[model samples]
Target chain A: AQSVAQPEDQVNVAEGNPLTVKCTYSVSGNPYLFWYVQYPNRGLQFLLKYITGDNLVKGSYGFEAEFNKSQTSFHLKKPSALVSDSALYFCAVRDLTSGNTPLVFGKGTRLSVIA
Target chain B: EAGVTQFPSHSVIEKGQTVTLRCDPISGHDNLYWYRRVMGKEIKFLLHFVKESKQDESGMPNNRFLAERTGGTYSTLKVQPAELEDSGVYFCASSNEWRTGELFFGEGSRLTVL
Candidate 1:
């Protein structure tokens, strides 16, 4: 079974400051990682995914994540934060063997970007 | 193109009452998935449907919950004798390609089992 763990329940960052939301995954084999964001009263929106490519994966809203194979981590990062960036973020993973399988998600981390 | 849409955006019912939620996937999307979020917890997968077939239902909580995707277009999930623990948001997502696995999601149906 593939699983994702996000240690932080909440993340706070000031405007113009960089922010990081941590996530670690455990999979039987190679994993397909994904990041999603959900705004208030809205559905989870696709941010980005890491299939098998460069360690740095960039996505919408100036967000990026570093995939560390050795550390078994894929931490979401943003060079600068905006008040509008405040939302709930989720990390998910699925084993490479089964692309059709459902993603195993981590407990979401609520991001609060302060102005 | 319209994204995934779920019916009964909010349903509040008493325990033991039956509630059925509906989801209509994006056109041409053959893969439909059901997931649930219990408050602040991670979203948990309930099942997956490939066309009209149940590809995987390993994550379904129990037999009390029944899901059917008839004719591979729209899916429905029926919960009988619901409990307080079942109060949460039920989300439906669809993906046209399995390899890419980028899913478009519905706003979700908020179910309250009182």
Candidate 2:
């Protein structure tokens, strides 16, 4: 089984400050990790994904995620946060070895960037 | 290009009623998928369609839910005699290729069963 865990229900960060939303995964085989953001009244927007290349993957809105294979973690980070960055973030994972399986998503974390 | 679209942005139905939800995938996209998120729960996959054919329906909760994609262009999910637990936000997504993990999602249909 492939699953993702987001420990924090909500994260608060100040504008222009760094922010992090932690994510961990459990998979039977190599994992394909993804991060998505859902804004109010909008569908989920793809942020980035980690398939097989560099551990540090940069995505939309100046966001980035670091995949740690040894720790089974892929934590999303942004060096400088903005008020518009506030939204619901979800971490998802799928087993690459499993043929065409659907993604398993986390419970999601609400991020609030205080201006 | 227009993104995936789902009809009836919001719907309120009485329990034991029948409801049909529709989804139109992005043009040129062959892979369409259905997922749902119940209150306080993570999003769960319901099924996957590849050009009007059911590739996978393992995630479907029960037989009360029926999905059909005719002409390989649009899809519909009908829930017969909906129960209270059937209330949730149903999301539809599409991808150009199966191997590509990136999926474009719709705004989703919010269903409330009383």
Candidate 3:
């Protein structure tokens, strides 16, 4: 069973400040990780993914994530936060067992950027 | 390119009634998927379709749920005798190919069963 976890239920940051949404995963095989953002009343938008590459992966909206294979963690980060960046963040994972298998998602974290 | 689209952005109905949700994947997409998120829960996979064929449906909850992609361009999911627990937001996604697991999602259909 592949599972992902977003340890924080909510993360608050001041605009222009750095932001981090932590994610960790457990998989039976090589991990396929992803990040998605959802605005109120809208569907989820893909942010980025980590298949097999350098530890750092860049994504949409000036966001990036660092994949720590040893730690089983892939944390999303941004150098500067914008008020408009406030939304719900989800972390997902997939593996070989996940042949066309649905992505296993985390409970989600609410990100609030204060101006 | 036009992204995945779902019909009936919102629906409200009474328990025991039936509801149908539709999804139109990208024009050239061969893989389509259905997902749902009940209140306070994470989004979950309901099923996956590859060109009018049922690729995998291990996530489907029960027989009350029926999904079809007859022409392989659009798909519909019908719920019979809807229950309160079935009230949730359903999302549809598609990908042009299987090698790239990146899925483009639609705005989703919000269903409320009272």
Candidate 4:
């Protein structure tokens, strides 16, 4: 079984400040990682994914994540934050070996970007 | 092209009632998925369908919840005898076979079991 863990329930950042949301996972083998954002009354939007690539992956809305193989971590980062960037973020992982398996998501982290 | 669309955006029903939610995937998309988020919990997968056939349904909670995608175009999820625990937001998503792993989600149907 595969599982994802987002240790933080909430993260606060000021406008123009950088922000980081941490996530870690436990899987049997190589993992497929993804990041998604959800706004109130909306569905989850795709952010970025890490299949087989360079450790640093850039995504929409000026966001990026680092996939640390040894640490089993994929942390979402942004150089600067805006009030509009505040939303619920989720980290998910799926086992590639299983072939098109469903993604397992971590409890989402609420991001509050202050003006 | 329009994204995945779900009907009856919000529905409130007493426990033991029935509710049906519909999802229309973007044209040409062959993979459709159903997921849900319980109060304050992570979004979880309920099932996946490739065209008209079900590919995976391991995440489905019980027989009370049923899903069907006729003709492989649109899908419907019917919950009979809804339980209080079933109150949550159900999301539907779709992606073309070529984009196998990437899923485009709908706004979701919020079901409140009173």
User: Which candidate comes out best when scored by lDDT?
Assistant: 2
Give candidate 3 regions above 4 Å deviation: none
Model 1, range B1-114, lDDT digits (tens) per residue? 898999999999999999999999999999999999999999999999999999999989998899999999999999997988899999999998755668888999999999
What fraction of the native interface does candidate 4 get right in terms of contacts? 0.66
Candidate numbers sorted by TM-score from highest down: 2, 1, 4, 3
Superposed model 4: Cα runs more than 4 Å off = B98-100
Best by DockQ: 2
Model 3, span B1-114: residue lDDT tens: 888889989999999999999999989899999999887677888998999999989888999999999889999999998999999999999987754578888999999999
lDDT of 1 by residue, A56-81 (tens): 99999999999999999999999999
Clashing pairs in 4: none
The full ranking of all candidates by lDDT, starting with the best, is: 2, 1, 4, 3
Error of 4 at B68 (Å): 0.2
Order the candidates by DockQ, highest first.
2, 1, 4, 3
- Give a tens-digit lDDT track for model 2, residues A25-56: 99999999999999998899999999988999
lDDT of 2: 0.94
Tell me the deviation in Å of residue A37 in model 3.
Answer: 1.0
Winner by DockQ between candidate 4 and candidate 2: 2
Candidate 4 lDDT by residue in tens digits, A3-106? 99999999999999999999999898788899999998888899999998699999999999999999999999999999999999999998878666788899
CAPRI class of candidate 3: medium
Among these predictions, the greatest TM-score belongs to 2
Q: Which parts of model 2 have CA positions greater than 4 angstroms off?
A: none
How many angstroms is residue A49 displaced in model 3 relative to the true structure, after the best TM-score fit?
A: 1.0
Q: What is the C-alpha lDDT of each candidate?
A: 0.93, 0.94, 0.91, 0.93
**Candidate 2 at residue B71, lDDT?**
95
Better model by DockQ, 2 or 3? Answer: 2
